[model samples]
Target chain A: MTSPSNSSREAIAHIAFDDLVALLEAIFVKAGTAPGVAAILARNCASAERDGSKSHGLFRVPGYLSTLASGWVDGKAEPVVEDVAAAFVRVDARNGFAQPALAAGTPLLLEKVKACGIALLAVRQSHHFGALWPDVEPFARQGFVALSFVNSFACVVPIGGSKPVYGTNPIAFAAPRAGGDPIVFDQAASALANGDVRIAAREGRSLPPGSGVDRTGAPTTDPKAILDGGALLPFGGYKGAALAMMVEILAAALTGGQFSFEVDWSAHPGAETPKTGQLLIVIDPDAGAGRSFVDRVETLVGRIADAGQERLPGDRRYALRRRAAEIGIPIAPALLKELSALAGAPTD
Target chain B: MTSPSNSSREAIAHIAFDDLVALLEAIFVKAGTAPGVAAILARNCASAERDGSKSHGLFRVPGYLSTLASGWVDGKAEPVVEDVAAAFVRVDARNGFAQPALAAGTPLLLEKVKACGIALLAVRQSHHFGALWPDVEPFARQGFVALSFVNSFACVVPIGGSKPVYGTNPIAFAAPRAGGDPIVFDQAASALANGDVRIAAREGRSLPPGSGVDRTGAPTTDPKAILDGGALLPFGGYKGAALAMMVEILAAALTGGQFSFEVDWSAHPGAETPKTGQLLIVIDPDAGAGRSFVDRVETLVGRIADAGQERLPGDRRYALRRRAAEIGIPIAPALLKELSALAGAPTD
Candidate 1:
């Protein structure tokens, strides 16, 4: 009946946490990223799962590896400064990935301020940085405030109109919290975070609906149709449309890179990856007044987190990391087997 | 009927925008804003009309005056250097109006960035700064890229969840465009911009149905019901929700200010004035290795703008501004009469 229905056979694979991390770290390092960058990037990818961003998690192993394998995403490319001025900094990714580009850029930013106490950096020609949290988290951990954004494929349309011309462009910000993990935030400006929808459709699952529009601009739950000709609807319509536009201009426009339609990472899937860039900003609290600024800012965050059930954006992920460390990650058994075979190891 | 419909009987009052600016400049000077700040702020508020944001234009005068009158938003207060340390600047607005705070903070950020060449300035305890574009355009005009965001009263809920927990926060970014005005972007995170909705409702027009949901979550085109108990729907929905959350956390969370339900603009008709804050990031082009960067950026923008009747983002406003100069400022007879009273002048 119905060719043994794709629904009943659908099952999620739960691979062990350590197994996934090891595989990621090994592949990333083998691909050419410096051990330090590799470790941090892997850690960040693992961290994505903790935040329930599984689509951006280690499941991206094949995709990322392919980028390195094809030499489109230079695993060992070191970022270099492309432009610098009184109030701006642009970094050339040199075709390297985003993590190292950001890492290289952050320190340069710190250096500029040592002169005048402020700097702005636009990082271009870089690949995705997995989750933006890690990009900002370090600064927060160091008691600094940071903001960042990156452009992906353009699948969203302008407000009050149709015609897909903007990317899901994600934006992020982080702030230091005393005696706690820095508050980290990362978000995409798509109704269903395209990634989740992609993953769901790949798994033969039906979306909760209202996430996208099918061809002809009607509300839809059928993910495949939505993905085909029906473009993604903006988050709050015009507001969402405006934001998607803002991100496109900010992340790409400011960087003097691909802005509107050129950002098609082939939907961040395999083959012919797109060229994208990033913008990272760092704020040194001491520059505003000095002395107890960090502590004071931390106090503010603490008060908010303590005020009620309130917690910072990355709190849930931090909690999940703790749980993963305690109870082991819960990847599907089938996924574990495949990863194991890919690693030339067998699942226990 | 209905006390003689004010709108239909209203006449159009024509006045040179310069005259209106002069009047506003005088009022602000009298209110104690620095001459420069007052002039600039007035210019910006007036420019909002030129940009088609009438709600933030002269319409906001009474509320701004009320804030000045109440002392919640100080006219005489200046920004205080609350903190600073390499690539970061934090300003305590000291309860000052937002324009001056932004004015004071923008240059400080530009000056501080030395090596990394990126700086973030977190500003707190500030009032509205008319249009976010004006606030950021200066940096781009100076060949520096800038991105800014402002959080207002909470106006939206997270995706898949009910109840308003975040505001329809607005975000903006300005990028240099060689010889052209910087490519400016500004937007909120709701189905329809709140101001647009308000203007539509005020004009006795109906929303294009599906713009918002009624109190019971049923879709309706009535802006009144949507504003009252019905909620604003997100663009592309969940994406919109995530975006609102992103803006709130960045604009409010990182600044040691209010966030989510904590935002309350007293003038917004339903809640207290939010403990608002703004995030200003400026990136100087020369902070890196390129010189023709501005021209390069323009090439890309030009290519897109030339693509079949696609005027750049802020072009219409500028065009309108130029045309309106000759046509004269067209204010409703009702509003003109009300504002004419500001100078103790005759209503006719």
Candidate 2:
């Protein structure tokens, strides 16, 4: 596919998912990542784009490149996977990206899950800068229930607290159903995701009420204020705060990684990724419900629809994924040009 | 303890923790529970009262008795524990109360956690009508991180839905800390717990906004309207609904138990308990962080405090428990007389 005409440069252009992944891989390699690391991250990033997870898709590329350029992360570090126990696998990411670390540990984690009926994978000293749903959805496709948690840089305040102590920690869950795509949900504990806030600021849009507080600790809807000296609030008040605290314990403490509050990257200017931890819990539902697990999930889906929830979580993503596969992932022409330039390809 | 004078009948009385447990045990036995089951449940109920969890304390006795009397639950049923795998344990509760079933499976579950570093317990055909924190707190006390999910009868409407397809499903988590009690939290997915709604109605108080909808599917704050053919809204909008859906999948579908929507007790009127399922996951943090887990927890706790949050999730409960131990579990004289009558003791 040739570049769109100059007259159509403002129009959206489409690229096959594989083509986009290759382009991203080239970009990561150009940015000094190991080929293996580049492959895993490129696929993850492209999948987010294909599935319309806008914040985690191409919008994150600049941050990734800037962080890499800042010497804050080891793009060439190999992950060390340890078989800690019968059902526990640990990965030392060695200051690398979390996606490659998770990819390196997947085989051992799956083996443990197969044998023990459940298993946990803990990756530490890593940066997870992608959508969490992509990390858990494949397990559900393979007939398992998977949950993943990752804590990022502290930007969220605890309920009734003035300072930010917790990250916009996100929890992702995926479970298999009988007839359709897996049921998947990934949500930030904060009122809104950091990326979404950044997008709002770029678009000159105000945030919803109760989204954050200004530097003075007074509630405000200005995304710029929240992004500058202000802080985001946890969703649902105290309950969401509790969930954020739990995520910190599970993703950071239990994994022996840096807490969100411990992440200090000021020395490396332009370092956007937080060096934290990630935890994944995978359960082989077959061991418990046998063949009936997916059937039961299907039943619940039907009832949720009957109860008037027209779109279950991840339904929109699946639809987008299908449309993208049929045609291609839509991308703005300027972004395509920028990606090509980053990958050292001719923009013509 | 002697009965209070008629003049003090409206005044509060105090009972020792052990004394309250014994009294509740006798009442359970009188209500047709096996002595062993009665002992376990009595202690559980008493602990709630001791901890100041009013809704799950002595206030639940009448509901328990009504359900037992209606023959909706098996007070004498023995739970059969199956060592399903290296890290999986399943319990057939035989339509018994969940506490006893959990008790029967605890030993095996602990063994699995010890051997595999993590383990899961799935209980089916069970009725859980008490506080969920008690189910997980013990594991944390034993130096493990534990999480539990339990689904109840349908009373919560999904987002954008008029009818209730999900229960006031509760998720409880407990984790050990270094300098204080284990961090524990038990929260209902609904905006308010069913017991809280009942309490509000009894006190002639209205619920907070966003609590629920009337029978006509219009939002209302009247507790009575929410209790009469109405339904609760999940806390935090669609996010809470997603969590509720996740709980139903984990607690019921994965356990081969009845979903909240499947719980039907019309045949046995006055059946206040929902025969659903429960799921527990226990992780031996030592397998990952070794001895540093608690220290990490302590650090997080300190930061939370420093951030201006005065109290953590379980702080109030622990304070109340300590006070109760210093004095006694407080109860109204009228309620004490009612308990005496239920226990078949002479009331003077």
Candidate 3:
């Protein structure tokens, strides 16, 4: 097939998955990331791609690495654990990349879930981390429920209003049960994933109908026009818009971070900077409500499964992750080349 | 104007809000909610109407009265505080009506928020309450950020799934800052609120496009068909479905209450009794993040307000409530008569 861009190039590269990881790590190391920060970020990047999330994959790694190189994001900055209570904590990211900040803060959330039943972490001053599913999985693995949301520079409109006043705030929910995998929900409150729209534009494809609107507030199917002047439309109309606002309040208001109409998410040209804020919360099933919570969750999953349903919500991803371990990480040929060059590593 | 089917009765009974409240209180007392419990449940009814949520108003009194008369919901069930930690509590509604149950549980949530910084209350095995906005208002008035979600019996289908698997979950988020009234968000993850569909069906009104489909899996503007054969559509296609599912997973799955597909919401003849669930979260703005949280919130609100044109959510309701309190709760003659007759109180 011909390239979607008018200026087409056939110089697509191929590199191994491990090579890419090494490359990302090298880039982060160059940017002052501590010993293992790059690996974590790379793993997140790979996991996102494997899960079919294209926008949040290796395409974002360079942006992340750039942010680290820029003083805007401290690759080696430690997330300051300022306030800690039974079920709440505040973490100052110290202008760090979100990957490490999130890595250091996730356990605190899980610990709170274990000790006190539920815990909430307000994360301020961090760059955009990869997909949210990977961030919430650790809690789900520990028989706990997890939820997270992030507020980026405003690019979405609030419901009933045409102007952009909020980010396409994303919300993720993970449920833990005694049987079967916990259902994990990760969604951006938009008509389609923002990444999908970007991919469509890059590939010169029309967006799904009603997915976005042009600058004149008229709906359009062209991705480029939608991205240039128009704002992303919220999913399910008002409900999605309201949800985006809820996420803003929870992520920005709760975290004491930049908020709607005040934050910036675009990558700075020739500068490595990130403009987003996030919040994480975890709930232990075995705590407050006791075993009943687990039993009830299991029962809930059972009924849904029993009703002759196809598959549970998070089952496919869990199955895919296990498969990845068996067959090694699945990286596209082009992504493999990028990672190889980043790492200068030998490939099979 | 021509009369709606709702106005079909030429000499419909009029009811005063206070008289109606008294009648509800009496009915609750007779059923078993005891003096204090009865009063709380009655208050919710009046509050719902005051907030202009007529769908959850007097129309529900008779149904609730019947539920109390029946043994399905324990009107006198005395919701007990099962566990309480620093900023979290779990309450067993004991199958009581949610109004009193929520009333009983909210103070605990607020108390925990004061003690531990943030608070969460999971109320399980409760009957349907009114609009979620009123439930959060009390907490919002106290200058705390409050969020709540109620999961009813599953009346909708999971996105991309073949069969029905979730409920018409309603979630509300309210925040209080120094300057403005609380920014209240009371919304359901459905194309149309349940009551609107029901009312439209009763009055023979056509649903808007994309709202629903007929039972044959085909799109239709007929409300009755949508309710009968078709399931209610989620707000943003899949995201709304995920949200409603997420709320159910939290409110019911985490609370150890019946899942949506298991319980019944509508009080249609021959239907099983209603057993619902709710989740409440409260955050103290001044605690960990200091005034910064409030400041950031105010800033965000201000930006939105100044963005060409867009009213802050809940502003209209706050204005209405203020005016109503200053003037009086207006009651239609028919409702006033009904309330007066039921309470044996003379109408003005």
Query: How much is the lDDT of residue B251 in candidate 1?
Result: 68
Question: Model 1 TM-score?
Answer: 0.78
* lDDT string, candidate 3, B60-137, tens digits: 766665666555777667888755556668888888767677777776676677766677788888877567788887
Candidate 2 Cα errors over 4 Å, as ranges? A2-7, B2-9
Top candidate, metric lDDT: 2
Quote the lDDT for B76 in model 2.
97
- Put down candidate 2 lDDT per residue, A13-96, tens digits, no spaces: 888899999999999999999999999999999999999898889989999999999999999999999989999999999999
Ranking of predictions according to lDDT: 2, 3, 1
Q: Write the per-residue lDDT of candidate 1 for residues A34-86, one digit (tens) a residue.
A: 77668767777766865567877756777776776765666777788644554
Cα lDDT, all candidates? 0.65, 0.93, 0.70
Better of 1 and 3 by TM-score: 3
lDDT score at residue B311, model 3, on the 0-100 scale: 69
lDDT of 1 at A116: 46
All candidates: DockQ: 0.29, 0.79, 0.47
Best by TM-score: 2
Score every model by TM-score.
Answer: 0.78, 0.98, 0.89
